[model samples]
Target chain A: MVVLTVLSLAMWLLTVHDANFSRMGQLGLVSILGWTYFVGLVLVTMGFANELLRTPLRKTWLLVFVLLLALYIFGTGSAVEPIASLPDSYRHAGLLEFIFQNGYARPHYVADFSWPGAFSLGSVFVAFAGQTNALGFTRWFPFFIELLYLAPLIVIVRSIGVGRRAAWFGIALFYTTDWIEQDYFSPQALGYFYLLVIMAAVFATWRAKPSPLFAGLRKNLHFRMARSRRALQLSRLKERGADPSPGTEPTSLSVFDSWRPRLVSAAKARRPKLVSVFDSWRLKPNPPIFGTQVVIQRRYVHGRVASLFARLEGRDTTKSLNTVQTLGVLGLLVLIMFALAMSHELTPYALILMLAGCLISRHLGRPELLAVAVLLALGWLSLGASDYWLGHLSDIFGGFGQIGSTLTDNVANRIAGSSVHQFAVNIRIYIILGIYLLAGVGVLRRATDSRVLEVVAVAPFFLLVVSSYVGEGLLRVVLYALPFTSLLAASAILPQQSGLIRSWLPDFRIFRYGRSSHTVIWTLVFSIVLASALATTVARGGNDDYESFTKGELDAVNYVYNHVTPGATVGTISPYLPFNQRSVGSVYWVSLYTSGSPTIKEITTGLLQIHAQYVVLSQSQENWGEIVAGFPKGWESRVFLSLATHGFHVVAAWPTASVLQVDPKIAKKG
Target chain B: MSGFLVASAASLSTSPAELIVMVVDFLLLSIRACSGVLGLRLTSRDSRILTSATVFFVALFIVLVVVRFKSLG
Candidate 1:
């Protein structure tokens, strides 16, 4: 019940915020003033009502009130237009195009480029159902994926005999961290989930009882020794009896008793008797053969020292074997990591560490040492060999003047070379990677109980101090990596201290609230409300007017498409439309369509070889000057004027740029 | 030429690399099949299939080279 209430309230808050109540005219004012008063009154009334009912009715009532408030908020907010929003980088050009075009099948050309077009299809299948887009689906995808990642973690926690609630807390804390949020939207999340599954399996096997092979061998060895001893004892008993009968011998109990005394005498005569308190406690009828030898040697210290040496050697040998095994595991893991890193995908370093740790613990008997070694290896490789560390170091240790110059140059280059959109993409990737690496390390530290936390905590501090060594961007990356590391440390420290606090203060209400599922529900609700509120705020802000395509360029492109024979060449200054239209002719400067590239000649030659009949010059978002400059000298002036006068013949002109057509002969020569 | 002959002789005494690869592949397949069977049984009994599967794979790998080889070979 408490959980439901908290969730409902959180949802209400999110909705209210999203609605931008403050910006609304009469309706917004009424909502803010009227709902606030009603909510306050309901809360006060619920307290008294609960007392009257002799139950905690306040929470239920409060939840109902919050729900009502959310309804009003949503009703007003829905009247406003939804802000025209672009999809996230990965979602926008790639997945969004696939979803819009193919309707979940192998359809093409939703975007200017094909790479994202391919990748986006998969994401569309995951995010949407058929042609319908549902908010519920989007909201719940993250939770389901998170639960999948937690399955192995729960197994590991259970293996250690931790309570279900504690395991849930640990897993929940991991999923809720900022790092998970960053990776949740990417393929890297799948890799991390798989790693967890593998680790859980290894840990379970490690803790299993001795294998059937070992058990069978032991049983056979024991059986043979027992049989031999029984036969020898029987022969002695028969001799002692001295029955002298043909078929049977009479066994004498006295012979066996006297045998013990003789053995004792023989042992005493051969070696000096040593007495100790522990001797009385020893449950042996006769001293062991090894003990007798020790007495004869009269070298107690020598025995002790030799045994110690044997133990040391045994441990050393075991460590050596473990080192070899760990190296094999590490090799496999490094390959996995390199593949992920090279792909610009998120790496599940935490899951890898936990798995390797558990495997060492179960099979090799020294998980901690193996974990430390693997960590040391990773640190060396990443810091010593990887450019990331070197760049960071250079920025930090280098003088202030150098750092300033580096920062200035980077900013200048970005401004000169790229658009705001491109800069945004770079920032997003860096932030995501920083969050992922930090969070991964945190999760690993929690799972393995390793000192990775210490290293991670100090990492940011070190980076901050060393910022002069590389470039200005190093500082930003360090800043992003720090908060995540600190959050992980806090998560690790909290559970240990929560119990102590509960015991000392002993506030029943507080304890009950903390233990209740209310917090989780409320958090979910709050997030929904916040998102809606933000959406409303943006919507109320107002809209911009801009045509996505210009009339003149669109006309020209349409003309070329209609007139040009199928499979005949057509050249367009607009590289995007050619790819979109699936034109048979040369698409001039294909390289410009993607992020900046250096192979200008290669792109041009490929275009010309295709026998493009129509050359298009678009004054679109792309640099038209650069495209024209690449054209042959003679055709340049004519092409430029033809585009300006007859641009209307072009197929499409986006709000930002115009498109132009080129003669077929110009394409053939080029 | 002598070194090549000696190396060829050594190689002929042992199995080819491809054969080793095939053996590894077969071993892994068998282990996976065995674990799958155990997992199905565990599911019916309300026990965790994951635990049973983990144990099965580890046991298969550890004992295969030593005990399984002695018997199968």
Candidate 2:
């Protein structure tokens, strides 16, 4: 708690007070201050860890989560002084404003209009609170959404059977490292909350029967065939006038004779097929399953794969749902699924994948849950989302299995620009790699009871195989997989138990340290938590180097919104300005808005042809060109020159943004 | 409730007077999500609420299909 509180206070003091900290000169006062913040963060995390390991209470962990969330999620945005950091938040607030004033989305316009649930929710929240705008909520939404994830996170970790200490620590680590920044005022945030709740609720409420569907069907089929064979034998015996009484079971000789042909056929089927290549795996009882559970874990070598899976995952062995509770949860599931289908594009699909994973793992009793998720996802995509996809079918299949490209977009591409930004990006990459490395170890260590859960954990990755969600797909897959991965990773420090690693890997002296010296272990964990928190805070807010707008920029945008006629076109070099606050009809960001790498001539011609009445040239727009689109360093100046030559004169100017007006009479002179 | 649902399907930012109705409509979505989890209790048999929810979802499915087909044709 102290660690988080200090981190929050220090963040507020350093970042909010030191406006030029991120862009400060090498080894300057601001740089010194930045270093101080990083060092302080590490020390505090260590202190928190020391306290957490000593205390017997789980509430300590929860308190730590809350505090870390405030410091990392909330503090990152709040530290940007008065204005909200991201330009998108301003647009979203405007979207809410428009919804409140107009009562519906402006369709056939704006990509976000198609997925209107989040905006509509914001409208209602602002109204219910009796506020006029969503600006207040927009600034601190990431914090609120992260806060909402607490209950479901706890339930999922515990259900996954991570030891209590491991669960708590892993969760803390997760909070510190989550730098995706998707928890903004967006549909995916709400959809994520729904997804977590549904998964955890399924875990808490019920489990499938010991006999899985496919296994039961197979057994029934075999029983019917055996019964027919026995009946045929009895008829043959009766015809021969031999005693084939019900009291007497089949003699060994008869049984051997009956099995001889089948045994010969089985041997013949297996005789020559065992080649040298896949010989080891050929006989390995691979899980050839379709929603069927096997009892014996390959390692355990004692029981059925179904029983093994059920036995290992403690949550998967719970009792069936009763009448009343069953009704309530199922009802809740439907409501959530519907809301998810409406609110977010990718989350419901993720939900479908995870639900199927649960059913395949025998964690869910009803096939109906999976069916509902599938139907809702497919129906929404095909019907509800037809409005978005009808004219843009190509958009759905743009990035298919381009792993290298996706990785570059999420990691490599982000490393360009300032050293501080590059450092933050590198840190984000390290923390992600760090957790998965531990999860790999945990899997070997038998961190969770059932190995099948690992398969379940990877289910969301299926989405990445085909679509990269327009470049950020892999990151989204990682986010969905975070809770499960964290659970497995936490098992690294999981006390000396029957871990998969412990069973397979011969005892190593290094693992002994995991079971000893609570003080040392906890202190190490605290350091990790602190490092991740620091990285996430830096990475999450690092976009402020460009994406953030100053008060003057917002004022310039407001001026455009108020002074210009409603239908007059407003243009920006990039969609990085907070200009769409009015949800007006004539907002046009240059070709660079939706497309990558617009040339200077293209920008000039596009704005000139549209006869854009007003244009914004902002620092963010320029930075976006340089870092993202590889525009020349003097692109901003060149754009200014182009506008000046095209009958455009500056109306208002600010350090961060400038508003320009184009005169039609003067434009003819150009 | 139906009126609110219908209102949610349209653009509300054009007029402020309808904000209250749209806001109420938004709350309906929240209420539907929150109530099920809060009211849920584990049972032996598929519960009565499950039946109601199934029927509700089936109805939702039909509504979506109808709306889509109507628009498509």
Candidate 3:
């Protein structure tokens, strides 16, 4: 109770700063603060003592009370600061400025060069606020988004029999992760949360039994009638003088009938017995169990393989396979792939042949042979072709190509003036990728059943290909591969092991460890470790550097908002600026806008038509310089160019690299 | 008349809007229960409405308090 109250108060104080203090709304502030503290205490106490609360109504009331308290705290804090006076660095600055000037608005611009892009729920929320000018929308909005992302992870852990404390730990790790932090200010992060929520909801529905409504709809009325007719037929057959058992020989039944009564009587006589002889003869046991058939088949196949190897080697091969063959195969594959990928002219044919030789040496079955052939064929076709058909194939099978493109782009950019540590980062990425790929293969090799191995192998390859395509970077491919590989490796190592090593891995016992409670401790530990590693790597790699750039953009936007007329549309050279500014205008500068659909052109033109008074260009060293150089001859004679040449002045410049300026005509128009 | 007066006092203690929402929530809950008993499945809208009604009552209570304080001031 104290913690919740303290946190709420702290957040409120941090957000409002001295805005409320200066306003002399001390009485209002005190009232709100007191209510917030009081309500927090009440809700916390109720939540803690929820088990003692007999009725569901009481528990619900407590939840509602907490929500209301949170609302009050947030609302009061939000109300303290005038929208116009808020710092430019704050996210949604343009929307806030619009709200201050126009009362309320929803977000308008859809597509932008922001993290997570515009086609997300977070962007929707931002757009809503910008378009509607509803200041109240900001309150409790982040919490809802966070809840959406967190709920899936919690449910997944619980479904896997993870304990409460561990689940909470995982949730906390998720909240504190770089992804969540990044999402806090950007609309794209919010979209990712929504995507996760949608996936979780789908998963939940899949896990549960079909909904009654769906079941009823699926159970055809005609089918029910037909079932009844069949039942009637069965009953009529029993009533007749014909044999009741369909498709059974009467002689077989008669033969068993002589012993049937004695068997029945003996079973009846032993009914009180705890262990009846007949119990063993029962067709199936109760306590219905569920397990993947694929896994069972894999285990069966593994047992067979172990036996075969034992016969071949004239000893138990388990220990030898685990220590020697596992490492050897993994190392060999990594070495082969690395060598092949690095070489400029390692023909797809040669690679496929090498893979085939490996498969043949491994004594893999015909199915494995066919699969490898197919994969190699696809790779070959992708590399050989350049036409449209080949392009499609290349797109599908061009993971390595994608990585090469990213490497080239990054390296070229670095060479052109960007400060990036390529070698160290790329190496780490490649190592992770190598490990991930090897782990997938290891899982396939070690899987007891061929079917299980096939299933696991196929999915990982698909994910690898898709991720590589989407990311278009070796580092990204490696990063994504890390989790998939870790999961597979962890599953393989822990399940069959015993004693000391088993203690180290995650499972029912290790997850619980020494704790008496039902918590899956190891899962929490794993999640935290993974999330921390990811966060550290992202931070080290300078992913957060984009935030600084965004800040500069926002500063430019603030200048425009302060100086330009309310209805005047502004044109910006950068797609990001226009999107972030929610400025509708004829954006002639960026390729993204120029090549966009008619709807985009319409939206852009609408902003300009409204009263676009300013044209601003951010002067970056690279692209910005090119844009400036491309300024058509005699451009200064034109009205727009003349305004820039004569009346426009740089308002703010960032480290003297980028400059934001205002046009004189904008002031005149206002 | 005494019973009616007691009922009116109880109702008055609750905000009119909140009480109305609570009654609606109660009715929805009862209907849902009855449907379950009759082996009839509730639609998504029914579930959403029931949930929304419960939420609405709580929201109404908070709104009432805010309105009352504002009016008093």
Among all candidates shown, the one with the greatest TM-score: 2
Better of 1 and 2 by lDDT: 2
**TM-scores across all candidates?**
0.35, 0.73, 0.35
Per candidate, the number of residue pairs that clash is 57, 40, 28
- Highest lDDT: which candidate? 2
Candidate 2 lDDT (Cα, 0 to 1): 0.62
Q: Mark the regions of model 1 whose C-alpha exceeds 4 Å error after superposition.
A: A1-354, A357-589, A593-649, A653-661, B1-19, B25-73
Q: Calculate DockQ per candidate and list them.
A: 0.04, 0.06, 0.01
Weakest ten-residue segment in model 1 chain A by summed lDDT: A540-549
Put down candidate 1 lDDT per residue, A299-394, tens digits, no spaces: 333323433332221221122223345444544543544333222211333333443433322332323223333332332223222323223333
User: What C-alpha lDDT, on a 0 to 100 scale, does residue B31 get in candidate 1?
Assistant: 37
Instruction: Sort the predicted structures by lDDT, highest score first.
Output: 2, 1, 3
- Per-residue alpha-carbon lDDT of model 3 for A615-651, expressed as tens digits? 5443221232122223333322232343444345555
Per-residue lDDT for A3 in model 1?
A: 47
Model 3 has a DockQ score of 0.01
Q: After superposition, how far is residue A174 of candidate 1 from its true place, in Å?
A: 7.2
Sort candidate 1 into its docking category: incorrect
